[model samples]
Target: MEKRNIAISLPCTGEEEWQATREPLMSGWLTQGPKVAAFEKAFAERHQVPHALAVTSCTTGLHLALAGLGIGPGDEVIVPAFTWVATANVVLYCGATPVFIDVDPQTFNLDLEQVKAKVSDKTRAVIAVHLFGRCLDIDTLRAALPPSVAIVEDAACAAGASWKGRPAGSLGDVAAFSFHPRKSVTTGEGGMVTTANAELAEQMNQLRNHGASLSEEQRHHGPRPYLLPEFNLLGFNYRMTDLQGAVGLVQLAKLDGFIDEREQWAQYYCEQLSGIEWLRLPTVPEGGRHGWQAFVLYVDPAKAPMPRNEMMEILQAKGIATRPGTHAVHMLAYYRDRFDLKPDDFPAARDCNDHSMAIPLHNRMDAQDYAYVVEAIRQLG
Candidate 1:
């Protein structure tokens, strides 16, 4: 294939995902049902969590995590300034303030010092994001936060990732995962929330189903078929359909293999691209096994032959796609205007905002594609 035809990411789904949807379609149990339960069970077990609730999307899953944790008005949630907007947005959804903190530019994860400085009596939670598939050091963050402050793992880009042998979803009090098309595994557009606490899980379960006291399965299997569930707390329709659940199961089953393949290519890219001094390659943390969702590179405009954006343009002309690691939420219009923020307010986030670049990294890419991307980047040097 030509360089221009190479995509940043292409879902590795095919006939298997199509076939998995057959049962859900034939039974007409398209809504959340047996398939969703099965997918949740498999996901929870894989992540070593006792409960995993399928939701509409990671954005909604994050909302559920905060709501289940009882985070609301007058509370604050710590968030790394360098992550996807959803991380900070979810806190606001709970009527809680998202206390933004600078990030460690190298890791693109939370700066623990900032976390310590920003946390307070009103701090109810910290949305620890494992940006770019590198799992966060949850143990250290837990030690840093007060016992009352919960850690919500924003594992949106970290499926199959781990820290010190503990999976990403199992490390935090509760974790939210994305199944967007770009992730290592996908259900087209869906998400799952995993937690070990039964009480919290029950609350999230109810909230995802419009705060129903009992599940649809409970009603369907009960003797009184006409009885409707009671509502205790207000909730949203965040349930994942059986069709999506079916695809999720198949995707979940293949997650390990997918991660392994990506990891290999990531290593190869690191080895091959290390020679370019002006380009900073990604590095997995000491105890973290990165899921390799996207292999993001940091371009130093001062030393590089061209500016970061110029290099991106040149690559685009070569048909190789690239994107920033993620946006700096504080720089976005809504947050900047609402908070009266400046670009330099968070220096590291601003630096990353202008320099971090994510090249093509996905399961669909073969050895030739990887080599082509590497050569194209090396040529830039």
Candidate 2:
């Protein structure tokens, strides 16, 4: 086995992040203070939404959104079968049933027809994930869905992604974005929720901070600094730290550049891999600006010289790192046994789970790294 210098994903960090952290650390007000407020404000302004709340993780952000929307037992939330398990797990956290829908084989997004077929009177919300940083067609989903069903955009992979000139975070009734290390723009580990609804924002805000009637800053900056806040509703401690917020500020500023770099590399991959009958590259739907979170491609084993896993192993042996795009959540052990799900229940997702592979396409890679990955794939003959 050869030692590979390439990485599957790497956060593009620099002196900006290090410099940004200094003030927050020196000030000694490290727990969701002014920096977190600034990050939320900036994120809200960038997404063109009325409110954005910083959270500890995208999972918690999703939980906050579902809980805020009053989802609980007896309710059904539709989610894609092919996505990170967290997308479905959050539905479970709210004690609501997650009705799994299949994904579009071409775009790897939630299939609209499956969505239409699965919706029921018990359906209270739908989680539309922007898989691989490509925005889902909100108009199509909105038209297919009943007026009562709420849409929660799972934009964990989408930071700079947009659809028809509208940003991803502003598309749904509520949205959750991740700033995990693997994301285009990262804060090591953080998340944000965006929404135009003030009421929902307030609900999520309270939910993230122990259901306090007032935030810590609100209580401390007021006429009575010693006064304690009253707990109104049940909540969780899902607040983003000042350290992460400070890092997020730097990452947010460089988000566009990061996306652009990934886009360029993705285009390069497409160009290099063109006419490879066995491989199917990713696609960006019309009016969609992909954030290019990962350049995932499908391997048709019938046409391909070897199986998808074999191809991955070959690439690994040749000094390249790769991964399965993501899991078919319904096929995972927890969801499978709990919901009695079968692979054939959502064929598209199962196919994706079996065939899709993600190649290296992060800001950390240079021309040499890109060439190496392309050459390694070409050698699959």
Candidate 3:
């Protein structure tokens, strides 16, 4: 295999995406409009949920979910330290304390046992992030939590993934999904919140669009045109644009095909890298369908002849792009200073954070690129 500059992730867009954008542009209603509503409807249908609200990004969706549930100061939200910073940051956005828990070594998701131990009187909710496109043990987690505690699924990476024949977004009280370029789908930048509860869905819709009881589309289409709207609660301008929604509709149509390609690429990686004793491939549990958002390999520095950083340098020098696993949220300066946390607080998260690396797993990669990445790994070993 020859050296090549393979990116870790890339958005696969083509003529269909361009056409979607063109049609929305020609409509002259670029803000939240019919396209956004159609995207929300289609997304909700795909996830088997009753309602879906399109937002600016997954971060805002999480924030809206928390706010809609009235989680605020004096409340504690349990989250995984192994996830992206936004997972923890959303808790802070709600003025709630984010209690970080270590991740399971095998699944790279929140450790259920640790979650059980972290619950307290102030613990109002648990934000379960399905890390690296792998679904968490939602049933087990739900059973462990007290009935009063709410479960919010941060399904940013596990959009099309499932657990026990149930869709990822439908497992929790509310779920947030991303349409960023790095994800399986792209809307330039957009997100959706899905829920089965009509009241929660309505509240989330209101919270995402400046706390208005009705959106512009509803007001404009109604008999009353100049009536003043009611502001029941505080909210933010987190609405997705019609253009983004149009692109999202097209991307959603291709999601299954994209996921199929990702699964195939992941299988190739597992097969080719199995012989590398120092590397640990990601594990997908039984009854779980992973979206393969990222093909992460854990490099055991103790067993590997080369250090993790050295192997990364070697791979980069060979023109293969890679990335460190998601940041250790507890160790980040903001969280550390705020919580006065030490590395010892969450050993598993710290260990995984230090050693894990993400390889290229985009839908665009062909057999040759996959072979090159495999060869690069073998050379590192």
lDDT of each: 0.93, 0.93, 0.90
lDDT of 2 at 297: 97
| TM-scores vs. true structure, each candidate | 0.99, 0.98, 0.98
lDDT preference between candidates 1 and 2, better one: 1
Those runs of model 2 whose alpha carbons end farther than 4 Å from true positions after fitting are 1-4
TM-score of 2: 0.98
Which residue pairs in candidate 3 collide? none
Please tell me which model should have the higher lDDT, number 1 or number 3: 1
lDDT of 2 by residue, 326-360 (tens): 99998899889988999999999999999999999
Error at 22, model 3, angstroms: 1.6
Instruction: Name the weakest run of 10 consecutive residues (lDDT summed) in model 1.
Output: 1-10
Colliding pairs, model 1: 4-319
Instruction: List residue ranges in candidate 3 displaced over 4 A.
Output: none
User: How high a TM-score does candidate 3 get?
Assistant: 0.98
